[model samples]
Target: MTTSAIKPLTVLFFFLAVSLRGTNGEPCGTSSIQVQTINTGETAAGGDSVFEVQVKNLCPCSVRNVRVDGGGFATTVGVDETMFRPVDGGVYLVNSGEPIPSMGAVSFRYAWDHFFQMTPRSLEVDGQC
Candidate 1:
């Protein structure tokens, strides 16, 4: 075949490969989520350091039932239970088990002596990517 014809064929193959990958019938995993904590340079009522926590969902699909290892999470300041609360076994639930839309995030604040080692424990894919 001519050089021009081969170039078009290569491009077609590339697009086909990418489309196939998206339809693999698999959902995003906990790895697609990220937990970030930042010191706000402020103190709470008890003189503990205040930290802002943001949990971001990086997956293209929506997710729900997101749980994290609270690790005995505590703070002098109050955090909304509907946003983030410990249920049991040191696991904290996010968004009251509601779906966190694709690329969406949940944020809250806490006051403690040090930053908590928050890590994602589990999540369920709510929709297709």
Candidate 2:
């Protein structure tokens, strides 16, 4: 294609990409999900154990589907979103319910038959801001 023709197409693509991020050029929290695993002594070997999963959003924008894939079956003790489930092989995915603001953190606990092994996390937000 001609250079001039390509320029307009490139511009259009750029705009579309920005719009999906957020409004008013706020940008999107595309890759800003932090996961913190805390060990709590609530059980013995192969016994019931408790753990805390802390998820934080370190982006200037927002993110969704803040999933934490931890090994073993678990129960959500506390969290803003109710869209949490076990995917496979003891991995769990949780929806943040809403966008997580920059530096905002969401914490939840789980009780399982084994220790905690979390991988790949996401984020959510706080009160309206």
lDDT of 1 by residue, 30-110 (tens): 777899999999998889999999989887788899999987798888998888998888999998889999889998999
Clashing pairs in 2: 100-124, 100-125
Model 2 weakest 10-residue run by lDDT: 120-129
Look at candidate 1 and tell me the lDDT of residue 59. Answer: 75
Strongest candidate by TM-score: 1
State the local distance difference test value for candidate 2.
0.60
Q: Write the per-residue lDDT of candidate 2 for residues 1-129, one digit (tens) a residue.
A: 999999999999988776555554444433456777777876534565777677777665555556666655455344334545665566566652555557777776666665466666434433332
As a TM-score, model 2 comes out at 0.50
Q: List residue ranges in candidate 2 displaced over 4 A.
A: 1-31, 42-47, 72-83, 87-91, 121-129
Model 2, position 65, has a per-residue lDDT of: 58
